[model samples]
Target chain A: MELKKPAMAGTTESSDVMITLRPNPEGGIVIDLKSDVKALFGDAIEKTILEVLKEFQVENALVNVVDKGALDFVIRARMQCAVCRAAEIQFDWGKEDAHGK
Target chain B: MANELMRTSLYAGGTSPVKMIQAGFYNEDCLVYDLEDSVSAGEKDAARFLVYNAVKYQRPAGKYILIRVNGIYSQELDEDLEAAVRAQPDAIRIPKVEYAEEVKRIDEKVTAIEQKAGLPVGGVKFWCNIESYLGVLSAQQIATASPRVVAMALGAEDFTASMSAQRTKPGWEIFYARNAILMACRAAGISAQDAVFSDINDPEGLKKDLEMTRALGFDGKTCVHPRQIDAVNGCFTPSPKEIRNAQRVLEALEEAARNHTGVCVLDGGMVDKPMELRARTTLAKAAAAGIKVGGVK
Candidate 1:
């Protein structure tokens, strides 16, 4: 789905990542990540964001992440919220099932 | 999670990943991942997704997990139900429940979601929050509305507001509602959970309130902080003296049975059916609390 607008989810709390998604018609999923654990888990965080984007079928977007040592599930949840808010779509359980599949 | 010890159902904010990750490590018997009052209106969607994923991927074991959804009439109810049912927590707690019809409605919706998601029908249980005068009056009907209703909690803050009564530490204002809810739960054969004490700083006050709660026959209490879990659990657990007395009563009954006699006596007093039942319940509670009670099964 194409992003309709810019939206953000999560916070700068101790174990959360604030994810911001903007519509990027030609950027092809550009990520700007600022995290204290960049040297250790940067690739894993970016990969989680990309996986959520793929699950939501968003091929082009600018993903801005402010990480505070969040886990993989937290990242996935935040990314899903951001994508759903940006795409102006209600969260569908069927889509979640498809993602699980 | 039905029939499990739910001495303290602690709330973890649905949007806070820190609390959600650490909630299970606490000694609380139940973890209530709250998506209603703790979450703001704008963050409702985020909280739903957060709680869903938390329960789906990182569910904590050995604790009763409950996802407290929004009110039955709210716009967020549908999405909350959809995500909550799919996540498959032990139960979904419906806040601000006022009528039996509301419970039935939510039960039907949950059944549909379970079917669509290929989950077992009636697998999802419910905990209703009776927080109003109307709800208290209809507590019996609400408790008996659906077979999946395993427990009902009294939301004192809302209930007092509904009654226009002053909230006090002594909790005289909620006395009637407490008994009403307790009786209803007893009549319906479901667990009755008491309201939160709200004052986390005063451990003495909490202890007093828990005394009243246990005396009123409440099975458990809602806790806002993890520090209160041990106190609540201890208050609900059967004491060593009670356990010993229960064992003696059971032993007397067993001896009578072996002697082919119907008379059972303990401590110079005849033990009746009610005493036997209370003793059994005491032993059961002791066992559930992980206390070693000898000479009793």
Candidate 2:
């Protein structure tokens, strides 16, 4: 699904990551991440974001993540929520895990 | 969870992750992580994720963990059940269960999920909240619908609303529904739970309500706030005097049994078959509550 409008999810609290997704005319994905542990896990976080976007088959979007020491599951859950809201899609249980496939 | 002294099933809103995590330390028999009614529409997805992660990682030891999913007719029910079953809580409480098929459908879904996840087939249980007039009418059928059903609780607020009656402190409004649910549970041999006493500040009122429900044969009650846990747990636990009386009756029954006599006298009364059963049940309740009984170790 493609982004209908800008949508966001998650909180800025510790062990969480706020994810915001916006439409992009460029027709390719771009990721911007800010994290305290960026120096140690920046590449890993960026890679996971791209991987999730690819899995959702979104070719164009601007993904913004502000991290507060969140684990991968929190990041994944937040990303799924943001994607679902942006695309105006239901989180189909048959096709997704508890945190979304 | 088997309702052994499941006195206070304290509800912790899924939005408050810290409180949910800290619930087990409060000594409440059951900690209910609530994702329905307590969570707003916008935050439903987030709360589901949070509750799932909490149940998977931070669930406390020695406390029964139950998750309250949304109603069967709600759009969020599927996601809620998916999360709850995958989280593997002790039980998943289905809200506003008005028919037997609701429990059967959820039971099938849970069993499928358990199989896919490689968990034991019947490891997860179900708790049905009979929250409407139809639910009360169909309580017996619902209780007997699934072997996974461990307890059935009355939801007085909605039920009273459905009946077009106002809630009163004396509980005359929900008295019949309460009794009906108790009778259904008794017939099905499952635990019966009472609804929450919403007046959090009124300890005396809570005590009165709890006493009434306990006397009516409810195994436990729901609590919205942690402060109410003391009264809920205490009311369900047998008192010292009651425990002593139960012990004396058991002793008399034992003596009678040894002498091949079916009748025995205790405390200036005749202890017969019914009295013997009551005493046994009392001792069991005391033991479940971790109370010490004289002459019964």
* Candidate that scores best on lDDT: 1
On residues B140-231, what C-alpha lDDT tens digit does candidate 1 reach at each position? 99999999999999999999999999999999999999999999999999999999999999999999999899888898999988899999
Which residues of candidate 1, in runs, are more than 4 Å off?
A: B1-3
TM-score of chain A, model number 1: 0.93
Query: Can you list each candidate's DockQ?
Result: 0.84, 0.26
lDDT of 2 by residue, B1-297 (tens): 343457789988887544665686886898899999889998998888778867776777778889999889898887788778888898998899999998998899888887776668988888899999999999999999999998999999999999999999889999999999999999999989999899999989998898798889898899988899888888888888888788888888778778998668887888877877777788788889887665753
Per-candidate TM-scores read 0.96, 0.84
**What's the lDDT for all of these models?**
0.92, 0.84
Sorted into a CAPRI-style docking class, model 2 comes out as acceptable
- For model 2, the superposed segments whose C-alpha errors exceed 4 Å read A1-6, A12-17, A21-76, A86-101, B1-5, B292-297
